[model samples]
Target: MTVTTSPLLAVRALTVRYGAAQALRDVTFDLAPNSALAVLGPNGAGKSTLARALSGLVPPVAGSFALDGRDLTGQSPDTIRRAGLVHLPEGRGVFPTLTVMENLRMATACDRRGRAAAVDRAFEIFPVLRERQRQAAGTLSGGEQQMLSLARALMVDPRLVIADELSLGLAPRMVDVVFESLRRARAAGVAVIMIEQFASRALDFADRCLVLQRGRIAWSGDADRAGPELLRRYLGEATAA
Candidate 1:
């Protein structure tokens, strides 16, 4: 006998517009559990828009998306998040005035009973956070801050994390550290959609690659084969850092 497994996410013809400017044009893809999909594009390619639309921050002008086989289109952001889709937007989304511990505590507001376990799990995943638990979140280095941001996101027990430009303004070493955290997340069976500027690193980390151009899917295929010329053409930037 054979058993079948379904995809963790399914998006079909996802379309979004900002006033008269179409942001996403019939974008569609499927992501399986434990998979990593790297989204690459030039500026104004509508990468961030796609993430916002999926998380319900921006309503789609047309199309549909689902999580774990459940239709999630038109759902509220909070409702979709509670159902296990988490969006980690660009920047270190931590409370600067709050201590690392306090920031993590905020993530557990919806699950008081799991607070302790969640904090422990976060520390276990990123031990550096544990060492700086009492320090102000704003006092950490860029890499450390990114770690805290990821740890806080995991507290909600999300099934998929859409990371948008996570490596934005960090040093080369810090980028390595941040990507390692993402690697660990994938190893633990959390699917990831990485919108990244470092095309080479992103392609190496993800198995599948989707290149967007002018709010449309310009190409989609195996990451290993996404040539540099193609990146230069569609990505509009050199593939190498």
Candidate 2:
């Protein structure tokens, strides 16, 4: 039983809606520093919606989130991102027209004191990027593009990384590499909130698991304890349908 201490982010009674349909309903959770929590559920489970709201891309209909006692409600995406809360959206958000090195150089909004070292760190994490630094981003393989995305996020020196569907549509080996990078983020004492489609992998990497179904929390607890049977209980109905 690993108790999360000194929560870095707290979401309470959060709600979101898309005109007539509700996407999230009174969702609440806390993420402590140096911890990882995985969000798992079937399609249309409001996982992406939650990520969007957290990143300040979408406004919440109700509820609030705080980071280190500061309210983040209704902040702009750039504001939230600059505050050391980085959001890596589902798609690899690399600059397709730019070269690998250029893409890394573009995200210079955060602490510029260590920009050079951060670029070096990014290259170290994904050696392929260093090899293809001069290559156009769009020409790289899917896995390589994903690596660039992760590397871009790291350039910010974020305190919390909200990664949504990081391994989606990637080759199996690339998925492993992407996850290993996220594991490194955790190892560096950064909090992570991962929304992943692969339940097994997410569960294994997370310290806690949260299952969302129909815009609400269905289950949440220790990740290691959430076995197949438990996952099936929440996801089975949708899978069988």
lDDT of each: 0.91, 0.88
Q: Which stretches of candidate 1 lie over 4 Å from their true place?
A: 1-4, 237-241
lDDT string, candidate 1, 44-160, tens digits:
989999999999999998999999989999899999999999999999999999999999999998889999999999998999899999999999999889889888888788899
TM-scores, each model vs. reference: 0.97, 0.93
RMSD of each: 1.3, 2.5
Q: Residues 1-241, candidate 2: write the lDDT tens digits.
A: 9974767999999999999899999999998888899898888999999999999999999999988778999999998987889999989899999999999988764556777898898887677889999999999988788878888987787888989998889999989888988987877678899998788888889999999999999999999988888888887744322
Query: How does model 2 fare in lDDT?
Result: 0.88
What's the C-alpha lDDT at position 227 in model 2? 85
Q: Where is the poorest 10-residue window by lDDT in model 1? A: 232-241
